[model samples]
Target: MSRLILRCFAVATLLVPVSAFAQFDIEREPINYLKGPVSDPISRLQMRLDEAEVRLTFDLKSGYLESVLKTLNVSETSQMLVFSKTSFQRNRINPRTPRAIYFNDDVYIGWCVNGDVVEVTAVDPQLGGVFYSLDQEEVDRPKFARHTDTCTLCHASSVTQGVPGHLVRSVFPDSVGNPILSTTTYRTTYQSPLKQRWGGWYVSGTHGQQRHMGNMIAKSSREPEAFDVDAGANVTDLSKLINVEPYLAPHSDIVAFLVFEHQAPAHNALTLANYQAKLALRDEEILRKMDKDPDAPRTESIQRRLDHSADLVLKHFLFVEEAPLTDRVQGVSGFAEQFAARGPHDKQGRSLRDFDLQTRIFRYPCSYLIYSAAFDGLPSELKAIVWQKLHNVLTGVDQSSTYQHLSAEDRLAILEILRDTKQNLPASWRK
Candidate 1:
């Protein structure tokens, strides 16, 4: 087994409760239902779906649709099967066009088929339930379907030949169905996309300092050559860099906010609450030093722009918070509650709410800089307006009251800050 798989098993073993071992029961009855052996094509399809669900009960690993034949004492020739939730349509004009289906596990399963579901069945292996098809149903056009090509376009990035599924790298905890830390070339062989971009190893264009490790480790450190903007060395130039857009936008917003709040100059904040103060102070210090030494390593222009970018990010966050929740930006608490009440599968086979919360929450750190920068870079007129609004809300809260008791306007102002910070990021910052 790979190290990642081993690690998962180890973690699972440790976390499994002793009661779980004692509760294991091999004699439990298998769930069963029947559909199909139908003459009509549409009827046959619906029957297939029903049979798949029956088989899935015995192999419940969450969102995985198992084949009835695979779980039963049947030969490979047995026809029972469960189609993946996603499928592709061939472009009539282009036979070479690629198509695929993405499973909940992030595996891509490719196939071509026409028409909607027709029949369904369920079977009980433990009880030996008989197989039969339900009445035929008319095909209805599907309202939503993701193209197979879209699946391959992304999955092609981390596919392993020997592995059954695509390698998905995630920071969340892994369950039986979802592997949190799958093996990937990016981690073991190729440089980690995150590290490569953030560590400043590769400068994008000719506009910045050259301080890569090779120069730092040399006996006589020398500046690396200016980045080739035309060739695209920095992350800004690399479209394939993972999560670059979302990550950078928020990062800039946070920086911007810090610059505005603290009016300090340093990039690093002394305290979380005082981040803005520190950045603003740092900017002032840099400007002062530059006056004394014209050839200083840091340039005033860069510092000013960084501050401006930070301000813009903060403004965007505020805007997002104020906006009503659409398909995106649903609050974490609300989403979790909805997921808890959902049936076996969401509309998309996978639970949309769970996926959104898990993926988006984990990626928050990626955008911290953008958010900071947005705050710092607000236009002078807007800065005064935001600052005053914030001040009034903060002052309005009584010393005796907790944050939960704050008035709606006060809450709205804070939401505005978050929304604006999220929404106003420049096109370059978007994914």
Candidate 2:
């Protein structure tokens, strides 16, 4: 089958990487996803709670949802509503009462009406996506526990490049909120076609002429794709379709949705790069020890692995394959302004968060997540390769057709922005 499947199977049997093949055991190896020490947002919050430094107040209506959001620094306006029965609490989510997701750069919080627990996911610098659940019941102490057993079944699939990460999926859901099995489902990304996006999600925004599969339900299981997507287009309000009073926000801002589609996969790419580099380096160490040469040159196989992983991260961080927008997209929840304002701007007053809704997602076409902890936490060897690749492309040294999307102006602007904003950039970048 795939190389990832081979790696998993090899790891399962050998518990270590072989001559050319490297084992990827999540538990015993470099990436101890579940057993390793975690410094994610939720884990740190737990430490504060144990130390009596913070208290999460619970309310009768939404339990600890509001307090948790405030504590986690996840804005309420970054909310997205999904009516599909896709989550662990799928039974509680439907067209009438949907599940709400709020997120910031590093953390995502999921809540449902009358749901048993508040789902939290934190992007650990080293561990990728770490899942946790907070109980709804009010007790003397509220704790967030790692919920890996169930979460990893879907998160750590081929979709996430065989790593623990998050994703956004679109499916044709029936009236009661069950996805129609006969129809096609999509794992949405920034490169996804607009017409096929947001099938079971409530999209609240305005886009002229362009039609998406949001804010509507499949009338028939047999003819799930027969519905007119135009009816869902230009939807500025989700209150008519579902009870918005229960949720923290009234709208599922399309801008936020668009950003999420890009950010989720980018996180997965970073995590994959991190995991692959660490594994490759460990294997290299083993080889060096066998040869009894402390200064042995890295194997070609190990070097290729590092380069490939860095290339993946660079492509995503630079938004190489982002789909161009056909029409001007606008959001009602003001998430765009809020997101753009939270920036590490250069002297030119430009940030990667600046949107180009008329033609593309971001104005500069570079991902703002370049400044994030996840990106910064990448292994030095992998990060160095990524930096070099970025330098080559940005400086016009590599004029290969693969990066023809970046114009001279775009390249110059991005280079300047990174030089001013990114602290850990290579010293040569400053020159």
Candidate 3:
């Protein structure tokens, strides 16, 4: 198991009370958004809100969702439904009216069908992920309530590497939307196998031979053995499992789930790296104040910590141990097509978003999230290491087994794609 996951389990075990979950102390660890160079989308949007530069027009004719979707450019086809009763508003969620989640590249918007608040999570170049909620009833101004204490109960746990970030889980849920705690729950990521994913979420795709824990509800039982997964295969539509009338999109797009499973951890790792860099710089300044050389080997304690954190992030960002696909998968809801269309293709019409669902997720082995703002905002010292490693690995200079799955053609294509489409690539990448 990864240290990141161990952190999540350790913290959650302490917080899960005998009857219910206890509040985690979030203010104890302050996320220094105020002190740092900030590029968080939500904070920027809030700035616009404060200046009256951007007005969210709430149409009572449509509802808060439509207005928010327009304001954020979050696609309707990006809708995903989860009924695990895991949110702050868990009481409002059930199998019939599951919470719907939608996302684009930069932000995720979540709403329970006819629920009170429209929840949103946005990325900050420095802050990783931050949570906010807008009142569905108060559509006049539609102010976002910045949540640190309440949302951090789950967001700031070890799941997010003890940082304010995002995570996804696969839980064994009963018919009433309660997760069965007796069974082992998976913190789903790119490294997680398909069969071990999507326990309480709706999935729409055709998996040739693999069986997963999605598309089915367990009866009142404590045993994972009670749940049969054969019924969960090749689920192209979810109308039989739940009422689709209340949701925005009918198909849950297995492609989208896979993308999310990969991107969430990638984002978390990037956030971790960003935070580590800031902390390192802060400590370096402290040493300078004490009349000590910050970068001197004797005083490089913080630098060593930064190096370890950078390597941890690189391990995840490089897909060192990504899960392999056993079956040929095809997605419903045109999600694959839409996702591919958004890509800034190279001269040969090649893009990182192109899918290879036969043996793996991406056509190229590298994660497209390397272009994310979090990565772009990485400290120069850490980014140098990442770029050098990327060049060596892609060029077969470092022929480790972890990246042996990448074909020569795949490497060349990825290299060309990065050179052409990705902005501000390292000079070393060309060699």
Candidate 4:
């Protein structure tokens, strides 16, 4: 099922040992994730609502969902539906009544039919994915409360690289929408194979001869592998499977699903990089103070941390190991056109958002999220390392095997596009 920061119910049955989780000192020091001030879109909107600077009109059916999406600038074309009971309001979610998730570059909104509240996750500049919930009650000025306790149990786990972030999962679901924990569940990403993706979700697209685990359900938990995948393949209409009148859109566009898959981990990587770099620098400063040195250069330990963090960011940013499509994929919804239209194109009119859909997700393998606030908000030291490595790879200086997927033409086009579209790029990048 699709999610913003909700726990994957497939993994919910298994209790993870505390030692297995990577602990980041998020509560104290420079990266005070809990006590820190947040500048995420939801928090900004909350402030406006508090001052009556803006108004959110409520409707009977969807409550404040439509208004919240409008106020946050989240597009309805970015909608995707999930049928699995994997969210906070699991009792209300099923194959008959799925949760509709809408998102943009910076924010994600989750709404289930007849649910109590609208779940939200906004990407903060430093804190990564900040969770919130707007009550579905009919009040003059509805409030959005920041959530940390339950949301963080999954959001800040190892799946999100020990940072507050988002993830997309694919799980085998039963008739009632509960994920069959006995079956193989995948933490789907840009790297996930098409066949292994979209389980327990409603995917509306046409991918010729390429089968995925969507728009279908498992008959018996004991025989999860006996699913008739062909029955669910290349599904264009979802009306027969479930009633679509309650949702904002009639289709849960495959293009939107693909983009969502890619965006979640990319945002996580950015968040991890930001958090790790900040924490590393803070540790270095503490060590320096203990040593009584005011002008000590950064230690190797700190540099290593920065290097590791940068690698994580670059790996996703560069689309290392992204799954290739066997055939041309098409989405019925206008998401593909609308997504490509959000372009900071070069003189050649090429954008990072431009879809490939034939062999890969993007024509230029570089992520469009490089222009995201999370990327832009990275620590200067960390960003410097990232830029240098990116330049080396794009300029053909570092032809290591990790980036072999990027052809010469691909590298050149991406480099030129970044030079034209991206701002504050390093001087070496321009050259």
Candidate 5:
């Protein structure tokens, strides 16, 4: 009977589940997934920015600002928060503390305030996201507001009716928004530290008052040539009035909003380009997905193609700095030497010279510089994608042969590819 009981106990032990054997036993401590060094404030700020859904359109990390900061040797201590009434204004006021009073559009009255930042218990009129700082620190306000009267007098005539915001006039066939061309109205009035009439978009003009030289008499409505002055005194050339290109009031309100209000980096041509590229890619992706559905009916393929073409054109504009590889060398011999040094080996263990007699062609350094520079300004996410694309090209894993060849036709093809590729990218890339 004892032997039988022992056999039963052994059977029960063998039948017990593995989980039951470990029952009541303490589990090993979880791996510290969040372990490591604490991140710095700037890194924290970047993470917050990502959380806030701020699309850093340009590569902010290695951008022109970084270069400028390096050249100036301007430390963080040297940075000062300043508010200038106008781009032409020489005086800049410290927003942290105020000594005098200024016009307040909200109350329609000028009052002397102790500081630039005012606590508003009342509801915000715009961007009703609560008038508070993210860091729980005091909210510093710019001296000027976007809805100010001085700003509206000139910008009101803008394409957006004085919105003083980015004028998204029309989406090109490729889905990129072409910035509303600055008209005579914008040039005549609206002054800002940035707003230039030339260089397509994003003010490339020097920040200053426009100097109007004179008017052509032949183009004038009134005949100033026949006008005479007092006895023996010459009449000032009526045809040549020194009319300054209307010092259109600077959109200080917009500038202030971009800089202090949003705490965004200063708007530049590069930023504008990045914004356009993102928009274009978005449009292309939507169209491509729509085209793929056979059940959706044979809808506007022509329109889609047109849009694709337009995107290609815009990409060309964005990549205008990339020169053709062929243009780099004076002759074929110099090109060959450079090509041999770069080593374009094929899968068949053959060099570029073995496959093509014209292996002497050199790659354009300027093109590489432009491509690399563009990647530098992109946000971290997009920068990673750009880096990946570049890596593929360098490894010959990607068909960037058209871009490498440097022919006009190849350039256009590469532009199209770039547009399509950008469109297919995830939305996270833009952010």
Candidate 6:
């Protein structure tokens, strides 16, 4: 039920935070995401493109899209189709010409047929979500539209925790891909239920006996319950729903969509964690100038705030509150198998990225996003707490029911994998 409150200013756009939850003045604040000396991988690529170190060719049917995916380390199998007229280029998007989104571990690419530009969102270690765009027309020289304030319109709202980040939304839409704004919109995360997902999008998958808001155009005046959801179940192809031609692949993989659902907010949560930690520590320095102690002798609040933020990030990293899949959820796309094959495993070849479609998102109750730059870029103090907490939970020292969802074998395997593969963990973790 999380939705961004968007409004159009004369020319500049604003990410209007939810008024009910009053917090920081995110709009006016100097977001470090935009304040980088600009050294993220995506930014570096942008520099290369601008300096003619790299050149991109425009293709007639987006052949460049396929090549670009390969270049970005994004997979072709990671495609998901959305037909919502809710993007910046709403005038160009429709159910008949849905936008195709693709992603891998840290990057997301968005494409629309006949659209003016291609969108890119990448995670930056120190800066959080870094957004850019490439013109989709005939061009000899290609440059990314990097760090524009307008993109923060939708990306940097309460939806993204007041930081420039990404989000996936589900909404009731009419025939034209225009969301039925009178109805409630859903900003999806891993915690979202299956029933309330995938509206305004075309999903091709098989979820046995489960119903969702996908594959149907909502009536302008009707409630969500009015549609026959069973009619949309088990859809493996999209030719019937729309002209699947003019797109890279005809399939809008459901497994990839589910993975996107889980990762988008997971990345945002990590970004928020990093941002919060940085600010807290920065404020602590100001306290030091005031001759106030951040510790108990000076101020007990410093440790408390840092601990709270770290705990929230830890909860998200471990998926402590992920919604259970009631039915045997399976996607017809080979994506599940393909995605599983690329994991970094333990001595026994198990990974946190392994999917458990029958119950929840993953076999081990840990997010692969923990390995992302955003998680790694957390203030060392906060990251230290996270690493220690992760070690405790994995080693059965902190076996609360919140994490009890993980089996003893799962924990042991995750511990072994992290200890062996993940560097800079607490030394006691290996012991």
Taking every candidate in turn, the Cα RMSD to the unseen true structure, in Å, is 25.3, 4.3, 7.2, 7.7, 22.8, 7.3
| lDDT per residue as tens, model 6, 191-218 | 8888899998889987788777888887
Off by over 4 Å in 3: 1-38, 49-54, 57-62, 285-304
> How far is 79's C-alpha from truth in model 4 (Å)?
1.1
TM-score of each: 0.18, 0.94, 0.87, 0.94, 0.23, 0.90
In candidate 2, stretches whose alpha carbon ends up further than 4 angstroms from where it belongs are: 1-23
lDDT of 5 by residue, 13-48 (tens): 434432232211111111111121222222333355
Ten residues in sequence with the least summed lDDT for candidate 2 = 14-23
Between the candidate structures 1 and 6, which one is better when assessed by lDDT? 6
Off by over 4 Å in 4: 1-21
lDDT of 1 by residue, 151-270 (tens): 333322222211011322212111111112332112111112222221111122121232111101111113222333233222233224212221111011111111111111111111
* lDDT by candidate, in order shown: 0.25, 0.87, 0.75, 0.88, 0.24, 0.75
* Worst ten in a row by lDDT for model 5: 168-177
Error of 3 at 118 (Å): 0.3
Model 3: per-residue Cα lDDT over 1-431, one tens digit each: 97567545543443332112112222323346434455666677767878888877654433478767777787787778898898888998988878888887778888887777889898887677778888878544557777767787688786777767787988888888888888788999988988889988888889888888887788657565476788888888789888887777888888889888888888877877766656555545654544445554423455565656666666776666788888888888887888888888889898888888888888876777777887887888777777876777777787878677677887778888889898888777765
Query: Under the 3 Å rule for N, CA and C atoms, how many clashes does model 6 have?
Result: 0
- Cα error, residue 387 of model 2, in Å, equals 0.7
Instruction: Go through the candidates in order and give the clash count of each.
Output: 110, 0, 0, 0, 14, 0
Q: Give the CA lDDT, 0 to 100, for residue 324 in model 3.
A: 86
| CA deviation > 4 Å runs, candidate 5 | 1-298, 305-431
